[model samples]
Target: MKRILLACSSGMSTSLLVTKMQAYARSIGDEAEIWAVGQDKAKEGLKSADVVLIGPQMSFLKEELQKEAEPLQITVDVIDMMAYGMADGKRAYEQALSLMENK
Candidate 1:
């Protein structure tokens, strides 16, 4: 199973997206451990995550998060703005999978 982490300013904003992503994973019979956390908890969260998807509002943190993830060989990227605004979990989930595949 892949572990996907979503992070934002408060963590709460991305919780709904987590739900949607979970549903999509289930639909495809994909085993994934997906969760969300606030910026303060993100560095710690990265330790267990396979990939980190930052909320659009938290895009500024991507570079820092990427730095943290690089050493661990984990992918860190910003969620697409359009997908995030619409809570398009499939697209977001696909993005995470793509990142891992490319990595």
Candidate 2:
């Protein structure tokens, strides 16, 4: 199963998106362990996550977060604004997978 750690400034929006990702995972028979949290909580969750996705609203932190995420060796990306605003789960999972593959 793939594990995805999604983060936003306060986790409020990403929390909603987590449901979408979960539903998508189910619909496509994807075995995924996905969760959402605010930026501060990502590192703890990252220990077990296969990938990490950040919200575009928090794009400023991407560089610092990348530094922190390096040791874990998990792929990290900023979720597309359109996809995130729409809460498209399948797109999110695919995005995560693409990052993982490239990493």
RMSD of each: 0.6, 1.1
In candidate 1, position 92 carries an lDDT of 92
Q: Candidate 2, residues 1-103: lDDT per residue as tens digits?
A: 8889999988898987899899888898988988988988876777878888999988887787788779878767899888898998888888998998898
lDDT of each: 0.93, 0.86
Tell me the TM-score of each prediction against the true structure.
Answer: 0.97, 0.93
lDDT of 1 by residue, 5-99 (tens): 99999999899999999999999999999999998999999999999999988888889989988999999999988778888899999999999
Scored by Cα lDDT, where does model 2 land? 0.86
